[model samples]
Target: MYVAVKGGEKAIDAAHAWLAERRRGAKEVPELSIAQIREQMTLAVNRVMAEGSLFDPDLAALAIKQARGDLIEAVFLIRAYRTTLPRFGYTLLVETAKMDCIRRISATFKDAPGGQVLGPTFDYTHRLLDFKLAAEGSLPDAPKAEPHIGPVPHITEFLNKEDLIQQEPANDKEPRDLTREPLDLPADRALRLQSLTRGDEGFVLGMAYSTQRGYGRNHAFVGELRIGTCAVEMEIPELGFAIEIGEVELTECETVNQFTGSKTEPPQFTRGYGLVFGQTERKAISMALVDRALRWKELGEENVGAPAQDEEFVLYHADNIQATGFLEHIKLPHYVDFQSELELVRKMRAEAMGTMQEAAE
Candidate 1:
């Protein structure tokens, strides 16, 4: 797909300079600082971090600023930068149960163990724009409450206690890495989860929506959704133990799917899980639905040929970087390629015309 751009060193340089100037916009206005983007435009930063498969907020914010607020372009920059960094050993498995949750809610039960905490949510806010924000004014500090003392229990635990939910077997084996190796078909749940976690938000959301709209209907209930920071631990081989390296903000969703019963086993509700970096609640919820849809085979349910159920279709097109690269390349210099296509069309038309003329004669 590489097209040779004959020669335009000066022109290219000028274009780069122009782009930089345009990105700065109106010299009078203050240029947005990286910290502002990191703190203020946090949601945008989170999306970039999720898609870029990188967890660095400052770097994600820098990418967002450099890309002129184009999130996809920012993700592309972050991904490109990610390749140049040295690889470190993988961290230990994160335990969501022990996460210091800032926000926790359950759609299934009105009263849950840890109690529903609607922390810093836009759920109750009206969509109307406030003109007051346009003016420079300070707002009153938000009310604060004491943090919860013990580990927040999962909602699925209630269903599990009565054997109402299917129990997934624990496996200690290391899962395959999609980044390290070529993606093969019939991907395990681990690999699929890895791809979905970093997949395009919109694409995943659409696929998940399709399933709910009867494409592959599996009634889903949000057993619990939690948003908070979890400590990331990395094992030190020298010390022979793991140590807390850092903490990362995360959103996790657990869905209780419809029950399946057979002659051999009793009816039990199934589960779908989604975990992503940052407070991307929507993405996390969508991911859980899609994950459940993709589990038809394992769940002993028939695949209804749904888009979400098609592993190849979902995984192949999930990556925005790959999709954008191929799509945007069409706008690039395709002189040689277009000329060949033009010649072929002309030849076909000429042959058809010649045949028609001979028949008329």
Candidate 2:
């Protein structure tokens, strides 16, 4: 006999309690502090911040812990928490040229004004797992250098002087916030870039890789990649001046792509840009390439029917939160729908059998 199951509330409560116990681990074990997570799991926190569109490491760390070390779930927690936060004001446009950089490099130039500082990177590291880190210990202190001698000017500014790249208008127009607004079709650069910054790293990487594998392959050179903290300033109407509310670490990437000129325009180099919260260079670089591929139409280049060129494809599938929610929602009750489909198929087959017998007779 089939009996309908009840006590869903009890079942849910039990599951939640089990989850809490699991997250905390045994009472004998030391409690995992938020500070410890923030310090030790910095890379995971960075990804959460980058995707969540928030910069608070501590909060991200807490979210990560609460989500049981699920990075995407941590990002979801941050995004949900961020919605309740009141917007005191918006930051003034951050001047990256004035960024106090920890790492800055350019592939287009041999030597730029800001001498390439290969600050903290894993580019040269061996992939072997460090067993030494299993035991708590400290390494020897490296020699420290004096503060940088002078201000580092942007390499792009040099190209801008000669007008080698397309000149962008410095309009003081206010841009729309992607979080508040529903994304519409034919998005402008501001919206596209904003969506991409919070996009899933793997998704962006795959789309960028597709472009490199001859799917709208526009020869791209990294114009600049920078990682550093920048002051977030907001203009107070009451004070009639901008104030430094806070600061956030950011990764910015700009790409110079080779583009064929159209009938109306002469041959010239074009640009693609990526900017994100925290030190996420890979995500930023991938975003820049994908951004360039999406701009084929605006640049008057031939549409190569690339996945990157498809704005709908890229923007819609980029966000992990949306993708995950829809993907996992299938776990919810669909028995009724399945039953209906099953009945329909059975009836269709029975009718087909009857029709076949009648035709044969």
lDDT (tens digit, per residue) of candidate 2 on 157-272: 78888878877667676778998887887888888999999999999999999998899956889999988877788998999998888878888998987766787556777788
TM-score, one value per model:
0.96, 0.94
lDDT of each: 0.90, 0.86
lDDT, residue 201, model 1: 97
* Model 1 Cα lDDT, one tens digit per residue, 1-361: 4344585889889999999999999999999999999998999999999989899999999999999999999999998998898888899888888888889999999989879888877899998997877886866677865545458889999999999998988988899988667678889999999899989999999999998899995789999999988889999999999999998999999999886666544788988889989999999999999999998887777888999999999988998999999999998888888778888888999999999999999
Candidate 2 regions off by >4 Å? 1-7, 26-28, 144-151, 356-361
Question: Where's the lowest-lDDT run of ten residues in candidate 2?
Answer: 143-152
lDDT: which candidate is best?
1
Error of 2 at 123 (Å): 0.5
User: Which residue pairs collide, candidate 1?
Assistant: none
* Stretches of candidate 1 exceeding 4 Å from the true structure: 1-5, 145-150, 262-265
